[model samples]
Target: MEVHAIVDDLAEQLSKSGERWLHASAAKPKYFEFTPVELFAVTERMSLAEPTHELSADISHLVEFLHCVKNLKIRGARGYIGSSNVVWNALPFSLHLCKNILALWFTDCDVKMVSGLVNIRKTAKRIVVHYSMKNIEDLLLESSSIDDPNLLERWQRVEEVDFSFNDIDSIHPSIVLLKTMQRLNLSHNKIVNIGDQLQHLAFLTELDLSHNAIVHIDEWHTKLGNIKTLNLAGNKIANTHGLRRLFSLQTLDLSDNAISDIESASAVGKLPVLEKYDLRGNNVLNTIEYRTRVFEGFGERFTEIELDGRKADDREKDTVAVRLALQKAKKEREDLARLRKLQIDERIRFLSGEEHVARSV
Candidate 1:
């Protein structure tokens, strides 16, 4: 059942029993206040009152009510009761009451209301704070420094984090402190550089930086060596030179970028394990022999890579194969012609040796 229905039923029972605290005619408390014990007492009396339909027997409703009450957090002057937002953001309750929470999300929640998250840093595994803060540094660090003792326990065991759709321009230094982070989404932000901030996250695998302002990724080889999936689509990247050392990367998204030269983009083909890449909306796609040249760069492993959301069909692969063979044949013919010219020159020199020697003398 919905949390509001449960609260309404509980409130109705309280009002019928002459509980004037929440009654319309009786004076309401200046501030909203309720405890698990008080709720339990009311539930016990309510269950006793309904002897025909025992509240204890309806474990689902009781469990639902308890779940809602557990999230009733007090934030400055206002608080939330069940699904109703009394106003403000902060921990729904005390730290002890929130010890078991596994996932926490704060969408458009003001900065002042999120100060309470420090209390449950050790408990939450998957945390999402979207469209909330402008600078991530202010949220995770003090004076832009991650060396504080108090910030050490924050995000200790978090495996996944989504700080997308914010006004973040640069990566926060404290983000590297998430030692156990595996997947991170920083897409739809204003990030410009793939800085060394994430170099130490050895456990991170998947990273989404799509739709950002990243123009150049010059030093990514050292930093993003462990990532398997990397999304750089809809950015201003011109080439894949920075991703040459991503030996572990299997999937790469470079779509909607400014890659104009096929040779410059061929840099990603050097990656040992790169299996999929998206180069759509790039200037290189308009060049003649674009796919063939790009496939040629992969050098015998072109068939293994997926380009532009599809694998090379048999016809396209045959075309690349024929082009490669023709190029090899052309090189061999050029080498043979050069050798023949040298042989003919030697014969001519042999024939003119005496004449040439006499003229020199």
Candidate 2:
């Protein structure tokens, strides 16, 4: 079937399903369960069904009217009152309408925080905010306290979140509250640091933190070994020390960084399952034998390799293996030196009378 045709048919089905729920008894609750796409599309209509003015009387003025919405989307919204400035107080009541929300989308607006939307937290499965990047300094400016229920509520039952295209500078510690998050997008922002709180996203599989000002990274999460995709392109990154824990990553994007040499990305070779690596537009790309050395630097088998969008042949993998063997030999020397130092320390302790005795085997 054609793609648009499928979407049109799904729309018709959802319209009928929503109308049926208006008068149906509580006996049949199956109507509430909606597909991710259906829920996302249906959210635009789930608001209070009232004008923006009513929201100004009090933040909770529309609570009764909002009670019927199951998926709320308030896009391009501005306050209808004096200064017409929307604040954090304006969000909860807008989302509080439906007792059982499936998702909430606040796009192209001035929403600043996710602190007081707990009314929908119990049932909301997804929370998304993108663009409308005028005001988001609250969530990224200062880390919220761990006990704050409003901040914690936003992460409780959520599975995915996209806070992209906002000029965010830092990550709030409250991000750790997302116990069920599987995919996260913080791309196209001004972010520079991603603190230890990221380790809390233990269930994450795909992470996009591209188009930022990040210069360094440390592998902070102990449980994200299964993450399959990571996009760290378009940053000022020059170091690769913190990526060793993502052993399961299959697709990695480290293009458009400040790395001047292939050896600087030696960590990429440590990822056991890496399949796709993008390295172009960096200083090393202009060097002789740069393309061949990249395969060895990546240190893994892959179906495809794109250097400046130009594909390399399969023979490069074998060439890469030979290079990696040399790297291994260097590492073995370092390990042997450490072992010898341990032996010397033991002998010194024995001769100094700090340890007693020796047994001949």
Candidate 3:
């Protein structure tokens, strides 16, 4: 049976009993709080309350039994139990009580941030800080913004964090502290560089830093061994020097950059196992014989390559095959003609008796 169904069954049994039961919070000094592992504690966790002067008949004791709720979504609620205007950001509850909660969505609340996040450090897997002003945005994920009380402790199981379109200038170093994080989207922000701040996330696979002000190529972060799909589109990257060590990269996007020369563009060919490469909007792609030279340059190792967002179609692929075949045949024919001329010269030397003297000498 579901948890709520079990709670309903337990509540009915509590009602039939002659004994009076009160919420652990209301009883306080008179009645003792039972341990969560106890059998009676599970029944008492339900909203079944014997009549009490402190609480109404049907009031749900959040602090006493909220541990039962796995996915807790606190939406539009002004404040926590004892939250006042003076300290509106602080949620009034023992973090240990809700340690069993799996996910918490604190949305549309008065404040964007809250204190005591370190309390539920164990079971809180996903924490979404969403406050929409007609839409959601993280004004900036600066060091002071994300560095809170035991943030790394609370964000242990968090795998995805979306802090986009908030004019964030820099990636807070604490983001790299999330050892379990896999995907991070900082796109459409004001970020110019990533540096070593994001290199420590050992498990991060997909990172989107697109539409940022990453002008200089040196501003990019190296040693991201786990990143597979990187989107650095619409940046000011003029060359691909910093990307030489990203051996794990599969999909690399350098589109719309100023990488406009053959020497700068050829750096992508050294990637040991690159699959899909997007290098559109560069001057080198506009050069004459860009296709034939690039095909010879990259050596057909890249299964799919797109320059200017356009790949060679089937007919063009056939033409390239024919061109390669013809070039190979022409080279073989020249080699055979050279061998024939060498043979004829050797026969002439033998008739002139020069071959015997040369061998003896």
Model 2 over residues 1-361: C-alpha lDDT tens digits?
1223333444444444544554462444322332222223223333325333322332232233245556566555344423545332343222333676667676655555333355565777776776654434444222344455334445468888788887677776556656678888889998887765666566888889999899877663453436788888999987566776777787778889987876776666666777677766578777777777766555445335554455567676666667777889999999999999999999998786743444321
* Alpha-carbon lDDT of model 2: 0.61
Error of 3 at 91 (Å): 9.5
Query: What's the CA RMSD for each of the models?
Result: 11.2, 11.0, 12.0
- What is the overall TM-score of model 2 with all chains considered together? 0.62
Please write out the lDDT profile of model 3 over residues 1-361, one tens digit for every residue. 1334434444444444312333432344122222111222333433355433333222244344444545555444334334435332333222344555555554444223323344444555555444421122121222134444235343567677555554567765556445677877767777766766577788888888888899865624464656788888878888887776677777788777787876677676766666677777767688776765555445445336554456666765665566667877998999999999999999997777976777889
Candidate 2 ranges with C-alpha deviation above 4 Å: 1-68, 77-93, 112-116, 132-154, 219-226, 298-361
TM-score of each: 0.66, 0.62, 0.57
lDDT per residue, candidate 1, 236-321, as tens digits? 99988888888899999999999999887899888888999899999999999788789888877889989998888888899888
Cα distance off (Å), candidate 3, residue 103: 4.5
How close to the true structure is residue 49 of candidate 3, measured as C-alpha lDDT? 51
- Please give the lDDT score for candidate 3: 0.56
